[model samples]
Target: MPAGGAAAGLVAGAATFVLMPFERVMPPLADGLPDRALWPSVILVAVLAATVFVAVWRTGEPAQGFVALLCAGAVGCAVIAALGDAAWLLFPDRMPDIVPLNAGPPPVRHALSRMEAQDAYVAAIVWGGLLVAVLAAVIRPVTRRRTAALRTLTFAFAALTSVAAAAGGKSEAVLAALAAIVCGMLTPATAARAGLPDRPASTAAGD
Candidate 1:
């Protein structure tokens, strides 16, 4: 699990670097940047889900883990959709002028307007927080020494998601919050089965 977490972190970090310039040049909320930028994260989530499913299946906890994975996927998708909706609703007047996803690079002189830029910033913060929460939840079991910290962080991310939902009126934020909570709970269970010291419960449960 440690190895897996390291690998995922490396990959995600690399991807972020590669995308940084593009993100700077293009508003994250503009065009398909939000969708396109999220592809790597989605892939990571899928891979982690599959890994957890297989691990749980091997340990005879297939049903629970599988359900968790499905819920995670649904929640993640809902979050993405809600974020997109929020971006659109953030500035209704600018919706028509917003660059289309396939319109090629926006003219250099035509950068995101002030309101659009603000929305883009908010989108980045929200999505980035979600990604961190997802990764932390997925890798918490293998984190050793830091499991408690990670768990706290995951809950904090969920709280932030809830706040975002309220401010943005994005229902998906609620789903994402629920998903984070579920993942936090499931991590310890799955880790206990896998013989990882995810938390005190694993030791106390005598698994």
Candidate 2:
């Protein structure tokens, strides 16, 4: 991996760990929804999404591919998190449990409180995903291969596992901590990838 990529990942990971414990401080996301027990994952995804988009749009460097990976992963996670909303409306009686997979207290944390209040989940997903995807595709192709992609998946998976583990142990703090970690890992990779500079190969005659 390039020095920049490693540096970006380390920066992101450290930041995420620091921000994890603050989940409880955030407001609730949904009122009528069940399984509204906690807010860790919500904050993590939201932060990553915003940071990724900002980096890609603002940076003039050649890190578009990495930025695209980060932004896309964030959008994908958001969609997965809210999928239950659609399931609930489609089959009220059979609404798949929105409980964290590991089984924890009903969530009090609303990750999308601000957006959910003004728009339906469907609209949120539609707009967010569309915008992110369009931007990623429009950017130049990412040539760094699987490092960025795999790291992204690893961070998300770890964060999700934390949520489940916390739920199993009935520890809300754990969930928040993991969420922050995930966000940290994601933000810099996106930003760095979006802002990385390209160096031209030196010619033997020093053209």
lDDT of 1: 0.47
lDDT of 1 by residue, 1-207 (tens): 333333333343344433443223444432355566677656665666565555466557654454344334433433443444454466545443444555445542134332343443335434544644654555424434345554675668577685866687444555455455445544443443354444555454343
The parts of candidate 2 lying over 4 Å away from their true place are 1-62, 73-82, 86-119, 141-207
Screening candidate 1 with a backbone cut-off below 3 angstroms (N, C-alpha, C), the clashing residue pairs are none
RMSD of 2: 14.4
Off by over 4 Å in 1: 1-53, 67-145, 168-207
lDDT of 2 by residue, 1-207 (tens): 122322343343333333332122323333323544234345445545555555556554436535544444434434433442444445445322333444434342222332233233333333333333333334443344332353444445444544444454322323333343344344333432443552233321231
Indicate the worst ten consecutive residues by lDDT in candidate 1: 1-10
TM-score of 1: 0.33
